[model samples]
Target chain A: MTPELPTPRVTVDADVLERNLQAMATRAAARGLALRPHAKTHKCLEIARRQVELGAAGLTVATIGEAEVFAGGGLDDLFLAYPIWPSPQRAARLRALAGRVALRVGVDSVASAEALGRAVPGLEVLVEVDSGHHRSGVQPRSAGEVAVAADRAGLRVRGVFTFPGHAYGPGRQRPAATEEAAALTEAADAVTAAGLDAGVRSGGSTPTATFTGVAAAPGAQGAPTSPGTPTSPGALTEMRPGVYVFGDAQQLELGTCDWTEVALTVASTVVSRSGPKVILDAGSKVLGADHQSWTTGFGRLLDHPDARITALSEHHATVLFPDGAPVPSLGEVLRVVPNHVCATVNLADELLVLSEGTQVDRWPVAARGANT
Target chain B: MTPELPTPRVTVDADVLERNLQAMATRAAARGLALRPHAKTHKCLEIARRQVELGAAGLTVATIGEAEVFAGGGLDDLFLAYPIWPSPQRAARLRALAGRVALRVGVDSVASAEALGRAVPGLEVLVEVDSGHHRSGVQPRSAGEVAVAADRAGLRVRGVFTFPGHAYGPGRQRPAATEEAAALTEAADAVTAAGLDAGVRSGGSTPTATFTGVAAAPGAQGAPTSPGTPTSPGALTEMRPGVYVFGDAQQLELGTCDWTEVALTVASTVVSRSGPKVILDAGSKVLGADHQSWTTGFGRLLDHPDARITALSEHHATVLFPDGAPVPSLGEVLRVVPNHVCATVNLADELLVLSEGTQVDRWPVAARGANT
Candidate 1:
């Protein structure tokens, strides 16, 4: 075979991707929750369209530029789930987005709320609450303050939102999801207490949003799903989980997904091998250098699940095969699942969509480099 | 006054960049070595042109895509410093690149050398030797085997090259450079013994290429330069260092350059703040998610060096300001120096060149996303 595909390129197993999309969509619909999957994960128009076709309410973006890309792709509803500090240029873009689509922005500070209000009057704003991530957002009790400020500045307060990013580590997803629900409930109460309608209470992450009955199982490393511990209905009305469509090593490590559920992988070629140590053409430039503290390695080989990518240079990934495992021959193609799928997807300009081991289409990462 | 320029963009100080270019060129010339700075650091055609103008013999690239882009930009001399396992598609591109420019590819195994030789006849190949980095490259003792194999496969064994990447950690540059020299010497000896002229002995890194006798200074964490430890003449004829033109936090920590010598920074706007914790609009998407063990933080604020970035999200950089230190106000613009400049540059689409606070030009990262 003349090499299945070019190495160091992002590839999505079409069958697995469709299955994941259906699973998440079915779960959300069953829960009676609006599924506005975060588009920052794939940044592809085709994926976003597929998401909407699967009953997604809208899309959540990270930057105004992402909002612009999705809007240009005819995505009319966008929620920038970031406390964006809009410069004059960005403020103009926000204004344009507000005029063109149903835009909702997150606000956690009085200054940001005022600036966003001034940038686009009557813009829908969600008061972000600290649901244990502690990265952004305000205290759940302080959501009212941000809501009042946004209201005073002529902005509309929709409700509250939080990211359970703390749900990422091993044995942490259950409590993190519980905390996410409780924080959203507290923030919703705070919004109502501030004399504002808390209509949209959003809380989720890939780990928390896909809870099944795996958490309480024997020998499980704390699954997202545990019997009778499902997130109480009405705890949050909407969910936003970015990485569910294409799981990663972090998700696998957290028991959020099985090996068969991984949709995205980098098709790489073995260029050189020294005994048991094999090097691939895919490296940090393609796989991205996103190593969480809990990740086993830079990435893992899909074909040989036991092999670990011990290190990465700009254009080379050093993989160490497990004891007695077969070493990949030079010129062999291997599928690699990166540690963080979101960052890995961000590295690619386009994704090669594969169905049954054949490339079907190329989807442009439309929102790539939309940092500003 | 209007904002100087857009926030969350990479900006290069024109003067500092020039100084950096001149400084490296002068050092390489003084040592009678040819400088082929790796273009993967900037991936900018303008910077490559400037390096060529400053007496650089050629540009080194990490990918064939980068080679194609730089070659298209009219830089004819290119060396892809990668052990590429070219698929049929890449082999065609490689043949085209070889026809257009003086091309050299790194090879560390017989299989790759044979494959490359079959793919493109009479291609120039450099046997890559492990100079202590241990990431790629064959052992020094084994380079002759690869060289002889290349010669047997109708490939031209021009010389040997090694990347002194182990020079990256604290108190490691001098020893790493020394090992790099010894490895090159050994590989060159082996090539000569194998009846081939190892005309080019290439070895370098940003930390190893710019030795300035600063490592031994009190409280210094090992610079590239130390007393009486320079490489002997003819040990290495060519040097390839990428990050000297835009020093990063790793360089600062390694004592490669001081703060004034740093050229690139991400201009960001203060979006939200509470007490000592401040958040900037720039985050991992703009600054890149590269964190070295020795790096102080994700990045250091240029205005407030004492303030350290505590955490990074997709679009927000959480900075922790020092006690009694001045905190940036909301909407205030701050320039941040990233930890790894190479990864940071790869995250951007263009670089905003600034001269004395005035925008001069925008250079496209033309060769970006050239992973294949």
Candidate 2:
């Protein structure tokens, strides 16, 4: 009895969401790791407040705008986990944000560290290291130099962090988790040798979060080279997994979460049907256009496992059903899990809350377009 | 100067935008086609008003929410150019919208046509016929049956439309345009034979818009068959091009537009610089992640043409410059054109207006995230 809401609407099941939040929080606590869940995935203040109530250390945001939103919602501990080159305008906003919360930012280069230090002096900073994902981060060996630069620029070097993004690839989750741990450990050591308090070595992505710090977990093949000595300042100290809160088609395909664990889904209607293709109203605008090369399709139908969304237009999803599988009739509502939950959530202004198959509340995606 | 705003800001060059609007309007006027520009690209009320002022016949939208926004913003006519499956909730909204605006919707099936007729009897409906892109719509020969169903269900069959989406492929613009004309003509003939008023044979996409209705124009390679006899109900009477307002990397690479024609770009700041990779703050979040396999990369830099965005995270665009190309320093602002303009504009809250290289105003994307 999924509520008959508008098509292409995002719906979050409250019952499953509580489980997801508690499960991740419990997992991180058992490993003695700080749970600073990435709020960029679910920009809802309700979700952030719940995460905090579940014992999360803080929240990790991708932009100063997001940090401001969450900080204004009364979250005290906020971290901007991006190599921010704050202009005077963003610097002023960051200064305002820092005044109300325990704000921390990421620094990957000396120039950015200096600019940030000049913008907001005495801000806590984390040296971003490349954990085999060479997008935007310094090498683990060069962390000491960047930390030294931040220290000289009047910023406190807290520790280091790396995103194990490569874990999303096939069969690379454990190896990426191991590389992330090793990179964070090396970077933390570098910062410590530079006479800075490198107490936080953070690393995690949804694919590798389950085995990030705890080597011998409940269902792990092997450990990631013994994730640093426990309790050491250089150990894996924090996890910032974003997509775990709302398991998506990617996480399900990667075996990170089962179908039962998904909390958020797009409710769409079968708008048109051809020979073997069923078009859903939910397309890239609602389900997101994140079709990973390794993924099976654009997304998956939660109830109809055999249905695959083969292509997407602005507002049309071309779903292909297997030979004898039943394709939904026109106007029939169906549940579709997005390929990437974060991209999907960012597309909608609000998410419909559901509990026990009944409509409950509506949570506004307050930071839906907080891109600046 | 580009305003000292935050990184990853979307900017609309007002001068270039006006030129683009006029260029398309003029082209349509010369071709005798109704210039119903697709408003989904910009979603700004100011741009829509300017388009109306430039003699546009009306606006085309992808969703009811978008139609509602434009209609509320003083647009009197709109067409939802998709096979929409309106449930009761959406039917109510559409009913309300049609009460004020000259609203029309697309229908490819008798079921949807009858449903729309029941929801709003006497409403004008367009039979969507497949030209070449088989994502949605019915075969051209089958348009009459759906039109007949709408006629019997208390709805007016106003015309037929086909989206020449295959024109986006490498050298298929002319072929797709030909296919669109031939298909629309056949569908309109079918509807006319069924005693229906098939006056509007609409078709166009950005890549194929210029060659859609006109036989020979400024840059015509050749003519696509002899278009239906002028003044006939089966003639191509309208063009619906969305991306012309904001020329993107896709349009530039397709040769539909030059770099100077680009009106919108993401103003990003260089946050980190690796050996050959320069990371900008504009990522998939700001610049929508619509990377077609045929495209060169995720996006392109407007000023530094040699630099290609190799990869993108949520908040980092990994740009690679060829050897001998001068890379911008950290904190240096640069303009990166998105691959798809429609998706890019949907991601931002407001567009920074620039006229003659100076800041003007901020236009909110009135229909952004209006995914109902």
Name the best candidate (by TM-score).
2
Candidate 1 per-residue C-alpha lDDT over B247-321 given as tens digits, one digit per residue, 9 for 90 to 100: 988888889878999999998988878888888888877787788778888888776768899788778899998
TM-score of chain B of each: 0.93, 0.95
Docking class of 2: medium
Q: Positional deviation of A312 in candidate 2, in angstroms? A: 0.9
> Quick one: best lDDT, which candidate?
2
Candidate 2 lDDT at A4 equals 56
The whole-model lDDT of each prediction reads: 0.86, 0.86
Q: Taking the tens digit of each residue's C-alpha lDDT, what string does model 1 give over A124-144?
A: 999999889887799988999
lDDT string for model 2 (A151-257, tens) is 99999889998888989888888778877877887888899999987888888988998778853342243434353433222258899998999999999999999
Candidate 1 docking class: medium
Runs with alpha carbons beyond 4 Å of true place in candidate 2: A1-4, A215-234, B1-3, B215-234
Interface RMSD for all numbered candidates: 1.8, 1.3
TM-score of chain B of 1: 0.93
Regions more than 4 Å wrong, model 1? A1-4, A211-231, B1-5, B211-231
